[model samples]
Target: MGCFEDLSDQELITAAKGGSDTCFGELVDRHTTTAYRVARSITGSHEEAEDVVQESFLRAFKNLDRFDGSKSTFKTWLLTITRNQSINIVSSFRRRALKFFSDHEEGEPELEFASNPLSQEPLDAETQLSLKRQYHTMDKALKKLPERQRTALLLRSQESLSYDEIATVMDISVSSVESLIFRARKKIIELVER
Candidate 1:
């Protein structure tokens, strides 16, 4: 375990492919946080994100041999898998929700963000209230974005991935990533201002 801790992701992948379970475990430990964050960004629910991450890792482990370092780094590849799994789960959930709602003659289900605990920093009540309002507004604006634009923005802003890494994860050209993010930001500002 100590030796595995010092190895790079590529090294871990090679060892894992050679039948080292510990190496694969190390890889999971290294990327689980990022994978969970990516999943949560898409699914917008902690429980769903956890399930998505678990299923993604299982699929990645099963298909380890198909990974090619020449095409993308392990993190990028794993995130791609996480993103696809999250989308699939979200789509499935939406389909089920729509069917159930239609049968019951109920309106569409609304997704709500879990309220954040108050900040530890000392702040006036008015300031805190204003911040919460701003957060809610921003969240609504984000939800209004097209899927690709929102994905590109979240990958860059939340995960702090480089343009090249984002391009690989999203399977788009670097220019396309740039365009998507730009449009996303512009749309967010427009929505927020109104």
Candidate 2:
């Protein structure tokens, strides 16, 4: 694995196409965390993000032959796949939530935030409560944005993708990416100000 680890993405892809699972495994290892980050930013749930990452890699593996090196880097291609998969999953969840609400003739279901078991450092009681409140407030503001603007903002601010990269991943022009991010930031500020 060390021998293949230093290889460039294109090189790994070439080796993978030649039937080397190790090469593909290396590719997955390299991009999995970033994929999860982008997915989490979109879906806002660790479990859902993990599901999207799994499905995205599976689809990528199946369609490797169709990938064209001349078009985009492997990372960009994989992200585009991850973005689409996560968005689709989120959209499906919204539809289900809507149906559930309609059936029950009630308001939206309460969402439970899963605590991070991996966080080992203990915080003071007041600090913990303050951080939790801030996190929830920010999350609520983000959720109020339109989907395109939210996704664009997450890609730029959370994932730190360039405008061109966001454009490619979101299938829009660079100018559109800028516009979406600008509007998203403005809306988030307005929401958070209240």
Candidate 3:
């Protein structure tokens, strides 16, 4: 009743379960940007990412009672849900896109860049072209990796989640997480050098 800002995520979850819409709103505010980032990374489209975030949050809210802090922190649990939802959305999009492409021929299959390349400040035209090419090559390499490996790398490198947190979110052993990241890096290096 005093101040929601001061309370931790666990406290907010508890309050929200007890019928405090304000606490749930605070939870949404705290996680919306991060959730969007995770969704965008997998989806590579602003509109799609927004849709995934909305759906993920709705699922989380409906199942909030099932969120057990003993197993993982709220952020870890929430991000796990976001990661999974984004992947599902991407898969769905790919299926639909492929069907569309089949109906109307459109070159080879290519990975779409999730982040905006044009968002960067201007550089010399030559340098920009080179960087763009490099970016595309690296993105293609990343897209080729197995889904688990890619998710492990993103959770660690992008989200800055600890290995333990990643293991928790991924529902895998710590050693498994380490192996996925190691293999992902090795494969990416091999692909990029070519």
Flag regions of model 3 displaced more than 4 Å: 93-99, 102-138
lDDT per residue as tens, model 3, 90-123: 7786757876777753343332333445776546
Residue 49's lDDT within candidate 2 is 82
Per-residue error for 176 in candidate 3, Å, reads 1.2
Which lDDT tens digits does candidate 2 get at residues 1-194? 33356799999988888888888999999999889878877877777788899999999988999888888878889999999998888789685786677764333333334344588556666666777788779889988888789889987886688898899888999999999999999999999998
TM-score quality measure for candidate 2: 0.77
Give me the candidate number with maximum lDDT: 1
Colliding residue pairs in candidate 1: none
Alpha carbon lDDT of residue 68, candidate 1? 95
Of candidate 3, the 10-residue stretch with the lowest lDDT total is 105-114
State the weakest 10-residue window (summed lDDT) of model 1. Answer: 105-114
lDDT agreement of model 1 with the native: 0.84
Candidates' C-alpha lDDT: 0.84, 0.83, 0.82
The model with the greater lDDT, 1 or 2, is 1
Question: What lDDT does candidate 2 reach at residue 122?
Answer: 63
How many residue pairs of model 1 clash at the backbone? Answer: 0
What would the TM-scores of all predictions be? 0.77, 0.77, 0.73
